[model samples]
Target: MYMNKSHSRIISMVALVATIFVMLFSVAYSSGHVNHHCNDSADCPICSMLAQCESSLKSLGTGLIAAVFYAVVLSQIFTVSLDYKYQSVQTTLVSQKVRLDS
Candidate 1:
C-alpha cells in the first residue's frame, strides 16, 4: 500500500515527540529529584546524582521500548485502514459467473 505524505509526517511526529519526551524525562530523573538517596547507607549529592543517573537510564530504555511498541500499533492501524479501503481489489465482481435462472 502507498503511504500518503501526511501519514508519513504523522509517523515522524510520533517518533519525534516520543524521543523528546523521553529525553526530558531522563533529564528530570537525573536531576536528583527522582532518586534522592538519603538513608543509612548513603547521604550526599553525589550518591543521589548517581542513583538518579541509573534510574534515568532505565527510564530512557523503557520509554524507547514503549515508543517502538506504540509506533508499531499505529502502523498496524494505518495498514488495516488501507486494507479496508482497497478490499475490492481482492476480488473482481465482473468475473463472477451467474446462471440465466437460479
Candidate 2:
C-alpha cells in the first residue's frame, strides 16, 4: 500500500465528496419523508431510517464544519511560512564562490 502523495490526495478527495453526497442525500430523504405514514410501532423502518439520518446529520455536519475551519487555517499558515522562507533564503556572489580578481 505504498501510494504517492497525489494518489492519496485524490483518494481522500473522493472519499470526502462521497461523504458530502451521503449527508446531502440523508437530509433530503429525512425532510421529504418527515410526515411518513406509519404506525408508531417499535420496529418501523421509516422511523428507524429517519432516526439514523438525524444522527448522521448531527455528527457529519459538526465534523465537516470543524474540518473546513482547520483546513483553511492550516493552508494560510503554510502559505505564509513558505513565502517567508523563499524571501529570506537569498544567495550572494560570495556565497556562490564567485570572485573578481585584479
Candidate 3:
C-alpha cells in the first residue's frame, strides 16, 4: 500500500486537534478552583473570584482548542483534496486494466 504525504499530514492534523482538546478539558477541570477565603454571604469575594477565574479559564481553554481545530482542519482539507486526486488516478488505472484485458 502506497502512503501519500497528504495522508501523513492529515494524521498529524488529527493528532494536533486531539491534543488541543485534551489540553483544554484538562485546564477546565484541573485548575485552582478551591475556596480558601471566607467572607459574608453577600460579599463572598473568594468564591466570586474563583468562579470568575474558572470561567475565564474555561473560555480561554475552549478558544485555544477551537483554534487548534481550525488549523488542523485546514491542513486536513488540503490533504483530503490530495486524496481525492489519488482516488481518481486509481479509478482510471483500474478502468485501463479492464480495457487492456478485454
Summarize candidate 2's per-residue lDDT along 1-102 as a digit string, tens digits: 799999999999999899989898899999899778877746898888898899989999899799999999999999898887435468898877988675
Best by lDDT: 2
lDDT of 3 at 69: 97
Ranking by TM-score: 2, 1, 3
What does candidate 3's lDDT look like per residue over 1-102, in tens digits?
888999999999998897677556555544554536565645876566666666766776788899999999999999898777434445566676655655
Better of 1 and 3 by lDDT: 1
Count of clashing pairs, candidate 3: 0
Preferred candidate (TM-score higher): 1 or 3: 1
Off by over 4 Å in 2: 72-102
**Tens-digit per-residue lDDT, 18-101, candidate 1:** 767766766765664644546654657666566666776777789879999999999999989888753454545445654457
Off by over 4 Å in 3: 1-41, 82-102
Predicted structure with the largest TM-score when compared to the true one: 2
lDDT of all the models against the reference?
A: 0.73, 0.89, 0.70
